[model samples]
Target: MKLIIAGATGFVAQELIRQSLRHPDIKSVVALARRPVAAPPGAGADGSKLKSVVVKDYDDYPEEVRRELAGADACIWTVAITPSKSKRLPFEEVTRVCQTSTLAALEALHEAGVGRPFRFLYMSGTAAERDQSKTPSWMPEYSLLRGETENRVLAFAAAHSTPSASAPPDFSACVAKAGLITHSYASSLFALGLRLAMGVPSVRLEEVAAAMLQQVTTAHGFEKEPLQNEDLVRIGRRALGEGRA
Candidate 1:
């Protein structure tokens, strides 16, 4: 399968790129980044499967860029400014990076004319509010904005859903609502405490990447959208086990 990974320099994207190279089913991986992406550690043997596409801006995809993205089977969109990171920039800039860029990429891909049943896995957060009307006290505005973005993605999926069995499914999208991501064993204790005390979810960075790769590589369609932390954990664990086989 041919896969496209946006924001390839990010932590999760790097993991996805690494795993895609190792996966026997994945034939090619397109790493879309603002700058050239280096091969992940241990990728020396499988470097031929990976290609890096550098773009000047996330929002703009010229014809040359589109040509590289053409015929992709799936895309994992990891581009976004996190809430904590958003505080450093103006709200407008944050919205542009977090939301506008997503829509732009979708447009570019559509224009590029990727294959039918194109799967798009968006990297969202657990705190994202689906109901934009009900504003929570904690980072309400930002959460709502993200929720709206998620809704837009879902709507896109709905519009592209196959109308009949005879017709091919044009596009499919799923959102991975990941929780607090921790990398070290020392942080596992804190993650567990947070999950038990506050009912918040946490997942390892590898788990998220594994789950996403599994989703795209499957021959069957995704059964669920907006995969929660537990869902990710389960899928990821299964994926990791499969990788070892």
Candidate 2:
């Protein structure tokens, strides 16, 4: 299957691209980034199956860029301004990158003529609120906005779903709401203790990528809409084990 890894420069996006290249069922990988992405070390071995497509802006897609994205079976969207990282940027910029870019990419993909049953996996954080009406005391604005974005994406999927059995589903979207990502090397004892004290769940980076690929590659797409942290951890572990064997 042809997979598109959007926001290719991010930590998670890079991992997704790396895993997709090694995946046996993945026929091609398109790395979509604002800037050019250098081929990862081992990715060159599958040189023929991997390619990069650079766009001037995430909110704008030129005709040529759309043409390059045509026929893609799935897209893993990792582009978003995390709450922790949004402190330094203006709220407008964060909203544009986190919310506007998402819808723009989806519209571009549709206009590009991506075939039926196209899968879109959005990378959202576990703390993101699902209800926009009630805001949490902590980071209320950011959380609400993220929730609204998720709702928009889910609504888009519903709008595109096939009305009858005779027609194929136009689009299938899944939101993977990950928690604090744990790194084998960077996660120290202090960090682990802090997370535990705060009651925040965490998952390894590898697991996140594995779980996402498994969702799209399966014969049937994800059974649920927003996959929680525990679900990802479980699926990711299984996917990693299968890949090793």
Candidate 3:
């Protein structure tokens, strides 16, 4: 499979890229980043790895960047400023960058002439609840905005799958809402306790990457709602041949 990974520098995205290289079925990867993404110096020992595309702006990618998108089978979109980072910027800028950038990337895919069933995996957050109308007061804007984007992506997928006479070629999208990522051993310990006590899944980064790849390669159809962390863990483990926990 040929794949495109947006936000290639992200923690989870990098793991996906690394694992994809090891999968015999994956033929090529286009790692798109705001800056150049370099292959590990000795990465070829396993298999052919990623082709990096560096652009100054995700929304205004250059023609050369567009050219690299040809013949792509799947796109894993992992772009988003974290809530902490969003707090530093004006909320308007955060929304525009997060929402508009997604549209631009989808437009680029359409313009590149990608075929039907071209999978697009959106890395969203578990906090984007289904009830956008009843958003919490503390961070209502972020929740609603992200939730709204999820709806838009689902709509886009529906429209693309059944293009009109003049509509551009497009693809399907599935949103994966990953839970709180614990980067440290302590965090992992906490996550394990949560999993055992509440049965709420908190994904390991590798697990999330695995699930994203699974959805990309053979998503039966677009899912209108987000795939929560527990869903990710279950789906990912199945893909990895570990079965369910």
Give the number of the best model, judged by lDDT: 1
- The local distance difference test score of each candidate is 0.87, 0.85, 0.77
TM-score of the candidate numbered 3? 0.85
What's the ranking of the predictions by lDDT, best on top? 1, 2, 3
Question: Worst 10-residue stretch by lDDT in candidate 2?
Answer: 38-47
Alpha carbon deviation, residue 186, candidate 2 (Å): 3.2
After superposition, the stretches of candidate 3 with alpha carbons farther than 4 Å from their true spots are 40-47, 163-170, 190-201, 219-225, 242-245
RMSD of each: 1.7, 1.8, 4.1
Query: For each candidate, what TM-score against the reference?
Result: 0.94, 0.94, 0.85
> lDDT, candidate 2, residue 22?
80
- Residue 229 alpha-carbon offset, candidate 3, angstroms: 1.2
Give lDDT tens digits, candidate 1, residues 1-245: 88999999998898888888888888889999999997898655578989899999899999999999999999999999988888888999989988898989988998898877799999999989989779877788888888899999878767866676764456989899999887888778888999899888898888888998998878786748879889999999988987621
Tens-digit lDDT track of model 3 for 1-245: 78998998888777777777776667888999988786543344344457998878788867788889978888999999888889899988898778889888888887887756588888888776546668655467887788788888777877777665764334667799998776579989998887788664588776788888877765364433468788888777787784211
Any runs in candidate 2 off by more than 4 Å, and if so which?
A: 42-45, 166-168, 188-191
